[model samples]
Target chain A: MKRLSEERTKLVFEKLTKYLGDNLKVLIDRPDGTYCFRERKDRVYYVSEKILSLASTVGSDHLVSLGTCFGKFTKSGKFRLHITALNYLAPHAQYKIWVKPSAEQQFLYGHHIAKSGLGRITENTPQYQGIVVFSMNDLPLGFGVTSKSTADCKHADPMSTICFHQADIGEYIRSEDTLL
Target chain B: MDVVNAILEKNVNSNKSISVHKDLELEIDEGTLLASDYNVFDKENLRSSQDTYLKNLTRDNVQVLINKIWMLQTERVDEAIVGILPKPVFVLPRARSVPKPKPLTKWQQFAKEKGITSKKKNKSKVTWDEELEKWIPKYGYKKAKADEQKEWLVEVNDPTKFTNGEDPFTASKTAKREKQAKNELQRLRNLAKAKNVKLPRVGIPSTEHFRDARQLAAATTIARASTASVGKFQSRLPKEKDAKDIASHVPGIKKKRKEAPLSVVQEKQRNKKLAESILRSKSTILHVDAPVPSTKSAKSSNSGGKKKSSKKEGKGAKKPKGGKGKRDLRSKVGGRKRR
Candidate 1:
């Protein structure tokens, strides 16, 4: 509901920059309505300025949720983007992977993506880069960090992890009832 | 209303009237108003019911304040009469302590050490100026006895030994200039002494080497504490000579830091507020031991939105619709690969 402080902004921006890269600027400063990141209950919400003002009118005790839940800070203060942030991350994501239909359910169930499940990967994708996982039809499902670069993937073991699951659409079904 | 009086009479059953304070200790400002009551508490009545006792006390104090305001002189302005409030009678604690006596100057310190007391040199401030034909201040504005301003002619006691037109006027001007320059230097030295800095013997400012060494030491210390990384993967070069005396001569980089643009501070404050707001919204009860790596246990914070409801299906975690058979099947995460 309020603006973020310098220390918290550093933490959130570092995590967000991992996935969005230079495009993180575009996500924060959009051509649409002005958007802001607000932290409530250790969770960061990316809401438009208008929604933030409205949400602020409600007392903190009664106010539950507003805008999109991007992620939450762990008790130790590390930021973790939730599955809800996939919408914002997908378009601006620098690295990407398409999953075969057979591996879609496994990703949704929070299992790491096996090399065989990777249908396609972006050219020259670097190892451990944050990437969006999509269906073969180009539907954004979840996001994760690439386990190996595109060149390494060609010779990687078929059963080895290609992408480590960070968040997925399944979370929209779990613990996300209050998410706007 | 008379209801309070009626209540007092009805509740008290005894004849003793409520004893209240005689003075109204009210302090009103541009918008803030404060009232302090010095009356003794009715402990007996408070033990039975605090509500009535405090209420009665407030009523009496308010009534006195109203009477005091009405007693003031009123002025007619617009539609209503307004009485200007007089200065408050109560003595208030000073907001700031009387500034401690200014740091002692060099002369004062010398006098103190020697047990010397100052005595006035002259009582009379004026002297007769023969040329001006009137009394003038010995040292102040418009002093007519200054040698440069007064000297008009010179007398030669021995005509052979003196130049005919020679006079003291020009010599006096140079003397005055030199005296003023000396005072200017002393003034700076006095100021430095008050600030607890020792100037070099030759000048009011510290020497070049002293200054450069102080700056180097501060820079070295700041650079070391500023970043925690061991220069990351790279090895550190030979350490620069530590400037030890800099701490005694100079304060920390506090003044340099304050010079940062105001926008930086505002941005920092905004981020801080956002962090606080996020912390405020999180449910505190559910926070337990750090599960760390996987933080995905999201229970609907709205109390009613319990996890694993049988009536819900696999539509999404937000609205679960599953059969009764999977109710207690185990695992916090839904369909998580559990063999």
Candidate 2:
């Protein structure tokens, strides 16, 4: 079995965040049914995961939901978290992500969790962690492995996609079902 | 009556300097005061109307004042007239009249009375004679008769033949007249020989000798001088040219050339530039500024604006003061046009 290292996961997310720095206003949607986006004051504009998720809803089966994330998150405002997400969609795992405020709940969870006496996540000292959730109906509960994906690099936030090597997941949890 | 008598009698002995009276007016020379009047009109009795001299003067006194005014106007008082006045009187001395004769002397009187004329006469006299065609001898020769005639005949006749004449004039070389005739014949024979010309035996005077002796002598001198100059010039002339050229080379002679000297290009250019410069200067002095196009445009715009504004205002319109009217206003307002 292989487990994903925190350093390797963070490196993948950092490469995606670099594209989304100053020019773009990005949006994301979380699985918990919350929407997140940044809007400009002068121009009417919107970018969101609902728009991104349309790619999947249209029966684009090649779209992968790696259910992994990694990147920087900052609590710079009340009820506001600036998450620089480096996410991946699959079957061809193209990194499409942005660094901006996340979907409403995602932003609240990231912002509230970081500011509630959590360890400092600065530029020099960044958080590197991830979660990999398996399908509960397809697997027997407590029988399937639910080991979180981790990488040692830096900047892990809630919606930041953390990609893992299939062999590394084998190192942490043995999966009897075929790899999706 | 007493005042009248007093004024009439006016002590002519008392005021010796004042002279002449007319229109019952005492015409005093400019400075004499009416002392008698002044004495009667003195300050203590100044207001005594009936008896006082000032009261007695009446309108008659104004004549003297008028005369004084006239004298003041016409005569400029000077120091000489001032010196003539009495001690108390303030005489305004007048400018002197033009000078007159200082009375005649005895000699002038005698001359004037006698009516004398100058004795000196102009002695010069003019005379004319028609037959002689010149003035004949006057006082001097008229008396010296036959002797003078003999000398005149001797001068007019040929020097070689005077034997027909005997009483030879005293004015001539009388003692040597015969000797002169012989010498003249010999001289004429020698002259013929020297010139290689034939001699006439009965020697006659040259026609030139009949002319005035002085004229003949002058002609001979002029001929001699001309001949000498011809010889000298002939010897000095260039051998290359003929007598025609020599004649042309006569002293003081000048020849005219066919063409004048060519002018330098720079000189022509300079003259052209000078002419152009004068033209430019003349034009510049008279150059009036061209009427401004902008003003014309503004004028047209103003007319248009007035028309449009009138249309907007409807019917009862005011015409703009412009064009000739503006010019008239400018002149009337005494504002000089800027241009």
**Maximum-DockQ candidate:** 1
Model 2 bad stretches (over 4 Å)? A1-180, B11-339
Q: Positional deviation of B124 in candidate 1, in angstroms?
A: 87
TM-scores of all predicted structures: 0.37, 0.11
Q: Write the per-residue lDDT of candidate 2 for residues B1-339, one digit (tens) a residue.
A: 999788878876445432323344344444454422221334555555545545435333555554454555343376333223334455556689767755554445567899965565864433454544555444455534533443454443555644445444542456557667877876666566556778543555577454765555444333333664543443332433222233344432234444443223332343334334443543332222112134344344434333321222110112112233344443422112234
| Residue lDDT tens for model 1, A1-180 | 555555777678766655766666675656786677777888888888778778878999898788988877776666767788988999888778999999999999877888889899997665455689999999999988765557667776677677778778987786567444
Quote model 1's TM-score.
0.37
Tens digits of per-residue lDDT for model 1, B1-339: 699998888878654343444654544331223456665677899999999888877777666666666777789999899988766665668999899998766778889999888586666888798887778788867763474466566454445644456444544466778988988877888898888788765744345644776675665554554545522333335875435545444333223233343342355355545444443332232132112222122211211232221121122222222222134545323223334
- Show where candidate 1 strays beyond 4 Å: A177-180, B1-339
Native contacts matched by each model: 0.02, 0.00
**Candidate 2 positional error at B198, Å:** 45
RMSD of each: 28.7, 50.6
Q: After superposition, how far is residue A135 of candidate 1 from its true place, in Å?
A: 0.7
Model 1 RMSD, rounded to 1 decimal: 28.7
